[model samples]
Target chain A: TQLLEQSPQFLSIQEGENLTVYCNSSSVFSSLQWYRQEPGEGPVLLVTVVTGGEVKKLKRLTFQFGDARKDSSLHITAAQTGDTGLYLCAGARSGNTPLVFGKGTRLSVIA
Target chain B: EPEVTQTPSHQVTQMGQEVILRCVPISNHLYFYWYRQILGQKVEFLVSFYNNEISEKSEIFDDQFSVERPDGSNFTLKIRSTKLEDSAMYFCASRRGFGLVMNTEAFFGQGTRLTVV
Candidate 1:
């Protein structure tokens, strides 16, 4: 079975701090996606990277896909309390299969 | 932006009972899926539906779980026999197409919290 593992299970930081969350997997994926989820809600897709070595930026958040498509990272610059939430990484294969998720990194920012 | 909507934000059922979760995917989406997340755990895929049939399913999707797109707009997940282990957040998502390249992402619903007693 393919599994995506995310590091730094929990991260607590003061406002304006920078944080980077990593997601790794031994299996190769055709595409990788990053999502943000709040408590009691389903995850919302933040970005999707289909090409190797692709970098996408969404305001203060930047997501990068590994050249080998086996790992990805999310970086948040000058993070604010509003940015606090559980960040999930999902890998997608070909066909109609559902995406697989990582355990996620729960981030909490204190103002 | 269109998003998936699920009914009954929360549900509580006795063991061995039946529970059905309902979802309304995006109007133009063609592929639907059901996923579950135990408390503080990774999201696990259950089933994926396309062209009025189950195109893919995971090992977690056994005889107890069934999905149907009964009509033009609604997708339903029926748990024939609820178990204690079935208590979790069930999320419904839909994609515009069958593959990631053409459609890209799945829009998820808010999720229904199911508690089995």
Candidate 2:
């Protein structure tokens, strides 16, 4: 079974602080995606990194895929209050199967 | 932008009662999928349907769970008998079509909050 392990299950910081959440796995993936979910809502796509060592940026968030395609990281710069949410990393294996999500990192930014 | 939609945003049912969750994927999407996330837990894969039939399913999709794309737009998931453990936020997702890049980004719905009493 493939599993994605997320770190720092909970994080709280003052506004303007930077943070990074990591998702690691032992198995390789065809592609990896990052999502941010607000309370009582579904996850919204943040970015998808398909190539190894690839980097994608969305506003203040930066996502990086490992060279091995077995890990990923999400970095937030100058995080604002609106950045507070559950951040999840998902991977596609093969076929039409749904994505496998990480345990997720819960973030809280105080204004 | 088009997004996936699910019915009965929230449902509360008694244990052992059968329930059917509904979803309407993006009109042009051909690959449909079901996933659930328990309160404070990771999102999990349930099943995947394509070409009017199930293409793949996860171990979590047991005998109690079934999926069908009755028509071109609607995809439904039925649970024969609900258990307390079944309580979770169920999400529906769809992709343009399975291809080299189609699986890169699968759009997800707001999700249905199911509470089994």
Best by DockQ: 1
Q: Model 1: clashing residue pairs? A: none
| DockQ each | 0.75, 0.72
Model 2 chain B weakest 10-residue run by lDDT = B96-105
Report the C-alpha lDDT of model 2 over A86-106, residue by residue, as the tens digit: 999999875455689998999
**Residues B1-117 of candidate 1: C-alpha lDDT, one tens digit per residue:** 688999889999999999999999999999899999999889999999988999899898999999999988999999999999999999999999745464868889999999999
Please report the interface RMSD of model 1 to 1 decimal. Answer: 1.6
**lDDT per prediction?**
0.92, 0.90
Q: Best candidate per TM-score, number?
A: 1
Give TM per candidate: 0.97, 0.96
Worst 10 residues of 1 chain A by lDDT: A91-100
User: Residue A87's C-alpha lDDT in candidate 1?
Assistant: 97
RMSD of each: 1.2, 1.2
Give stretches of model 2 more than 4 Å off: B100-103
